[model samples]
Target: MKITKLETVIPRDIMPGLLALRIHTDAGHIGHGETYYVPEAVASTIHDWMAKRLLGANPLEIESHWRFLYERTTNFGSRGCELRAISAIDLALWDILGQVCDQPVWQLLGGRSQDKIPVYNSSAGPSYAGKSNEPHDSHVWPGHGCVGHEGPLNDYWSVVNRPTEYVQELLDEGYRAVKMWTLDFAAHKHGGPLYLSKQDLEVGLRPMRAIRDAFGNQIEIMLDGHGFFQLPTAVRIAKAMREIDPLWLEDVIRPDCVDTIADFRRQTDVPLAVSEMMIGMEDYRLVLEKRAADYIMIDPTWVGGISQTHRICNMAQSYNVPVVMHDCTGPLTLLSGLQVGTATTNVAWQETVRSQIRMIYPKLISGTIQVEAGYAHASDEPGIGGRWLPELFEGSTYQHRVSEAGR
Candidate 1:
C-alpha cells in the first residue's frame, strides 16, 4: 500500500513528551512509531525532512525507506536526531507491515521468543528516567535507581533513604532485579568535574552496602555508572562492588572508550553491562570483538530502529553476548523496545522505570503496554498506538502535515 499521509503526534501529558511518527496508507492502515526526544523538534524533522521521502513510497519497504532516510542525511546528519527520526519511521513502517499481515509486531519480527523476557526495575520515577530521590508528588524519574526515595517516593532516584524497605517492596512485587545509580550527583548535580574524597567515596558507596545487607543474594542488583566517572574512580567502584555480586555494572566508564571500558573490565571481576549508545553493527562488532562487556545494552531509540536493533542483537548473539534493551527514554521507546525484546533470542533483560506502572503511562497515552510481575508483555495491537487524543494536541499542531499519496 502507498503511504497516504505523514504527521507527528505528541502526547503533551507525557513527561518530556514522546515524538511519534504516524504513517497513513491507502490500504486504510496506519502505523505508529516513536523517537525519544524533544517531541517538537523530532516532529519537525519527520515532517520537514523525512515526509517527502516517504509520502508516495510503499509503506512496506521498511528497509528501503530506512536506507533512503539514512543515506540522504549522510552529509547533514546521521547519528543523533536524524537517526532518531528514521527510527520512528522505520518502526511505523513495521507497524504497518504487521497490520497488513494481520500479525502483531512481535510475531512479525520473529514470533514471540518467550511469553515474557526477564526484566529489571530501573527504580526510576514517572519522568521515564529513574528517579534519584523519591518525588514528593506522584512524580518519579526513570533515571538509574541509584538515588533513594524518602517519605514515600521522590524524584531524582539515587541511594534510597531506606534501602531495606525499598528492596523489600520490589521483591514483594515479584521483581527479580533493580538498577540504581551512585555517581550522578558528583558528575551531574555537582556542577562541574567529579572529585570524590575518601568520605565522598564512602558516601557514594553506602547504598551498595545497605542494599546488600537488605537483599543479600535474594535480589539481583545492578549498578549504573551514568558513564560519568573517571577511569580510576570507576575501577575502584567496580572492584568494590565485587563484594556484593551485583548483577552487572553499567556504563561505569563511558561506553565510547573501548580502552577505558576494557581497563575497567580488567580491573574488576564484577560483571559489566556496556553502553546503550550503540547505533550500528560496526560499533557493536568492535565492542564484541574486544570483549569490552559481558552484556551489551542497546537503546533502540538511540540506536537504529527495530530493523537495526534486530541486526545488532543477531550480531551480539553470534558472539554469544547477551543483549539488554533500555526503556528509560519514553513510551514508544518502551513499547518498541519490548517488541524487539520479545522477538530477539539473546536479549537477556529489559530495563524499565518501574514507577510508570502507576500513573505516568496511563495518563500519557491512548494505548496501554503493561509490565506484569516485573516482566512486560507485547501488545497484540495491529500497529503502534498513535491515535492520540485531541487533548494531547490542545496547544500544538503538526509541524507539517501531508495528505494521502493517492488523494
Candidate 2:
C-alpha cells in the first residue's frame, strides 16, 4: 500500500522517553516504530525531517526507504541522530509489512530460530522517586533474590528498595541473571575519577563483592560502567572485578572510542561488552573487526530496528563474538530486542528489568512476553504483537505530541 502519513509519539517516563513513530498507509493500516533517543527530539525528527522524506513512498519497500532516508541525510551525518530517525521510520515500515502480510516481524526475518530466548533482568532497582538510602527492606524490593542493588544508596535503593533483598526476590522469581549500573554513585562519592584511589576501587567493588559472596555464583552478575571511565581506570576496575567474575563488563569506555575499547579489552581478562549506543551495522562492524569487545550489547531503539539489529548479529557472528541485546528503557524496547534475539544464533542473553515487567507489560497488545527460568519467547501474532495503551500514555511526562501534519 502507498504511505499516507507519518507521526512520532514520545511517552514520558523517568527512564528515557519512548520515541514511537506511526506510519499510516493509504489502505488505512498504521504501522508503529520507536527509537530510543531523548524524548524531546524523537518527535521533532519524525515530524520535521523523516516525515517530509517518507511521504508518498511505498510502505512495503522497507530497504529502499531505509537507504533513501540514509542517503538524504548523508550530508548531515549517516550515524547517530540521522540513523535514529531512520530507525524509527524503518521500524514503522517493518511494522506495516508485518501487519499487511499477517505475519510477525520475526517470521518475516526468517522463521523463528528458537521458541524462546534467555533474558536477564535489566534495570533491577527501585522506582525513580523512592528513597535511595531507605533501610534495606526485603518486603519492599521485588527482585531481591538476584543481586542486591549496588549503587548510590539513594538512587540504587530507591529503584531497588533493599539491594540484597531484591536479589533474593529475583532468585525467587526464577531469574538466573540480573544487571545494574555501578559507577554513577561511586563516581559521585569519590568526587573525581573512578579509579584514582584504592578507596574508590574498594567502594566500586564492594557491592559486587557483597552480591558475589551472597549468591556464590548461583546468579550471573553483569556490571554497567555507563562509559564513565577512561582507558586506564576502566582497565583497573575490570582487573579488580576479575575475581568476582561478572558475566560481562558493559560500556567500560564509550562506544565511539573503538581504540580505547580495544585497549580495555587487551588489559583485562574479563569479557568486555560494548556498543550499547551504536546506531547501525557499520558501527557494530567496526567494533567486531577490531575485536574491541568479547560481547556486543545492542539496543534495538538506538541500533536501527529489528532489521538492522539482526544484521549486526550476523556481522558479530562472523567475528565469533556473542550478542547481548541492551535495553534499559520501556517494554517496547525489551520486546523488540527479544524478537531479534529469538532469530539470532549467537545471542548471549537478553536483558530485562525484573521489577518493571509488571508496570510495563500490561500496556502491550498481547500482554507481555513470558519469561520463565530467565528465557523469553517471541509471539507468533501479527506485527510485534504489542500495541501501546493510550490510557497509560495520559498524564505521563514522558509523552510528547507531534503535529498532525507529521502523521
Candidate 3:
C-alpha cells in the first residue's frame, strides 16, 4: 500500500507541545503515531520536509524511510525536532505494518520475551508537565516547581511533603520501585546545579532518608538529577545517596560527556543510570564504551521510535546492560515503550507516572495501558493498540496540518 497523505494534530490543551501524526495509505488503513515536546516544530519538519519522501512511497518500507530521513537530517542535524519528527513517522509506519500483517507491533518485533514488564512510578502529578496557565520559564531552575498540586494523585507533592506516607501508599498499591527529584529544588536554590552546600545537601536528603527509615529498602528508590548538577556536585549527591542505597543515580550530571559521567561513576559506588537525555545510538555507544552506566535509560519517542529503540536494546544487550523505558511525557511514548520492552529480553522496568496514566491518558488515547499490581501487561491488539482520539482534532483549539500526495 502506498502512503497517500500525512497529517499532524497538536492537542496543546491536553499536553503542551505534544504532536500526533497520522499516515494514510491507499489500502484504506490509517496509522497513528505521536511524540512529546515541541509540537509545532515537529509538525513543520514532517509536513514541509519529510512528507515529500513518504508520499507515494510504500507504506511498509519502515526501515528505508527511517534511514532516509535520519541520513538526510544528519547532513544538517539529527537531534531535537528533526529526530523527533522521524520518530513519529517511524512509529506510524510500524503501526501500518502491524495492521497490514494482522499482528501487534510487539509480535512483529519478534513476540514476547517476558511474561510481564515491571514498572516503576516516577513522582509527578497530573499537571507536572501538563500545559499550565502560569507563565514561568521552567528551565531557569533545576526543579523550580517540583512540588505541584496537593492531591491524592500528586505524587510529587506527596513525596516531598510526606515521604513515609507516600512510600506506604505506593507500596500498598504494589509498586516495588519509585523515582523522584528532590535534589532539584536545592539545585535551583543554589543557582542552578553548579554548587550544593552542606545545609542544602541535608535538606535534599531528608525526604529520602525518611523513606529509607520507614521502608528500609522495601522499595527501590531512584534519584533523577535531571542532568542539572556539575560533576563535583553530582559526586556529592551520589555520596550522600549511598546512605539510602538507591536503585541508581539517573542523569546526575549532564550526559554530554561520557568521560565525565564515567569519572563520576568511578567516584561513587552508587549504580549509575545514564540517561534518556542522550539521544541517538552514538551517545549510547560512548556510554557503553566508557562503562559509564550500569543501567541505560531510553525514551522511545526521544531516541527515534520502536525501530531505533529495539536496535538500542540489542546494542545494550551486547554490553550486558539492562534497558529501562522512560515515559514522563505523552501516552503514545508509554505505549511505544511497552511494545518494544515486552519483546526485548534485556529490558528491566518501564518508567511510569501513575498520575499521568490516571488523569491525562484517557483524554488523549482510545485504549488503556494495562498495569496490574506493578507490572505492565502486553497488548495483542494489532498496531500500537492505542491511538489518539478522533475528537482531539475536532476541537477548535487544536492545530491540525495535512500534506496530501499529488496536492
Best candidate, lDDT:
3
* Residue 185 of model 2, lDDT score: 51
- Assess every candidate by TM-score: 0.88, 0.86, 0.97
Q: Model 2 over residues 103-218: C-alpha lDDT tens digits?
A: 98888888787778888876444443112333544433222222344553222453234456667767787888877665545443333344546676775567677778888877
Q: Compute the lDDT of residue 274 as modeled in candidate 3.
A: 81
- List, residue by residue over 99-207, the lDDT tens digit for candidate 1: 8988777888878887787888776556444222334323322343234434234423434565667777777877878887755555553431245555565666677
Q: Lowest summed lDDT over 10 consecutive residues: which window, candidate 3?
A: 134-143
Stretches off by above 4 angstroms in model 1 are: 128-159, 189-194, 384-407
Q: Give the lDDT of residue 233 in candidate 3.
A: 91
The residue-by-residue lDDT of candidate 3 on 121-175, one tens digit each, is 9988877667655444565431244576577588888888998989898899889
State the displacement of the C-alpha of residue 201, model 2, in Å, after optimal TM-score superposition. 2.1
Judge candidate 2 at residue 202 and give its lDDT: 74
CA shift at 389, candidate 3, in angstroms? Answer: 0.4
lDDT of candidate 2 vs native?
Answer: 0.69
Best to worst by lDDT, what's the order? 3, 1, 2
